[model samples]
Target: MASQAESETGRPRYVPLCSSLLPLSRLTLIVHGPEHGHRIISPVEGCRRLYIRVNGIVQGVGFRPFVYRIAVRTGLAGFVRNLGDAGVEIEVEGPAGDVKSFLSALRDEAPPLAEIAELRVEERPPTGEKEFRILASRDGGEGGGTIPPDIATCDRCLADIDDPKSRYCGYWATSCTDCGPRFTVIGALP
Candidate 1:
């Protein structure tokens, strides 16, 4: 006899019965019941990989660096990069628990300038990667994503402008990761 259990997801699970309950007279016992689902459990425990695509005001606002820092701090291994004009793409691989935590932090701790519109996640096979890296921007897509509006100079940039020793000292075009020119700077070809 085997005890039945239900997981938190309301799925039925099985647990082994104590050996004392099984008498030597019974070499094998078979129990048949209604089919619940086709879920198969894996015996091995290890890390999982996830591919995440984030759409919206995720570019030109230090989103890539934000993700890279988060991944490294969380002990994850993978890469993050700009997806042309389609937002950003990230591939993260780590222990299942760590990966989940990283994902949560990614959403909660996004850069101040980032406005995430949509986030899609998909499972992927582990790539056995040991370190996380920031990749170069990729091009060629539908390119219909929203372009962020030009942001006013932030306090840091203002301070940099005021500091005599700063490279941007007294510079009128001072800018930084969180604040700078954006859509307004581009001009169409005639």
Candidate 2:
């Protein structure tokens, strides 16, 4: 079943199950779970797309939530998702600085335990979407990767929470790719 790993402040997280089992089974279980929230979307005739990949202790942790916040802050346009191999993949659009800042933050200020081994970024045409998002993990064959542990909240997110009237004000579970929870739930299942 799919579950969440909350941040220190108690924000909902996207904790994916270990993919040692069959891909189809994992997909079915995760998608069927009650807590597996998805990005709401309205049908659009056209949109842009970008592809990015981040390798490290990203899975199970609150990487998706972190990415969501980063995407919003950078005025970027794209989606971020967890990969089966303990890594993160994202696609975004905006000014070059925004993309660079986003990537820089991945390592300079990542989740508490998120040890980023590598980051692969690529730029392509836009998908015509107005906002960024976090997407459900897709079945991409066997997953022999390791799962990271839960993480603590980042300082920046915490500061944002402390500042009233901020977009993330009172967002106790505020997180970015640099800080949040991970692997705690992986042990609870199977």
Candidate 3:
């Protein structure tokens, strides 16, 4: 028997049934009373997942570290990795709101040296991941994207070079993610 309660105007009210037992698709079903049945209830919120691909000058520009920092700050659990010369790939899973916020910050708060040509976002099933981390780089087939150009030394690196006690003091090639040469350096096979 359905439980009944007194309403404000002396009317009898029937308690709504629990919808969790039903399938997610059928959660909107209405259990009508003898008369009108216009009462609506909110659906349960669920976790969300997103697969993001960022292209153009993302590699070697502190993009992965930037993403990791944002994910940690936003309390998201996922992984970020370099997609070869193509760009970077990210998988973020968390509450829907947090996921959205993370995505927004990823675009708006990117590193200064990172040049984002395009950003693609796809929805996926939540994997219930517990932590966010940086993954190793992966090859993404042929036709790689443009390589990042050499950038001038940043203020921080300059400061480090000027500091007499710093290890990199007076070092000619001293640089960091935010400022460094990408393709200008010559290398020999070991």
lDDT for residue 6 in candidate 1, whole number 0-100: 79
Candidate 1 residue-wise lDDT, 40-148, digit = tens: 3322124678999998888878899999998998888899988767589999987777789999988999888889998999998766677889998888544777777
Quantify all predictions' global Cα lDDT against the true fold.
Answer: 0.76, 0.61, 0.75
> Candidate 1, clashing residue pairs?
none
**lDDT by residue for model 2 over 1-190, one digit each (tens)?**
4446776867666443322222423333423224546542222212224577777666655678878887788677778877656567888765556667777776676666566776776656644455677888765623456566455786788889999878999877787655565455454421
Cα error, candidate 1, residue 181 (Å): 0.8
Query: Taking the tens digit of each residue's C-alpha lDDT, what string does model 3 give over 1-190?
Result: 2336878977777653232233445544343555556555433234577899888878778889899999999888889998755578899977677788998898899888788888989997765577899998887533457666788999999999999999999998999988889777624211
Top-down lDDT ranking? 1, 3, 2
Tell me the TM-score of model 2.
0.52
- lDDT comparison, 1 vs 3, better candidate: 1
Evaluated against the true structure, the overall lDDT of model 3 is: 0.75
lDDT value, residue 131 of candidate 3: 86
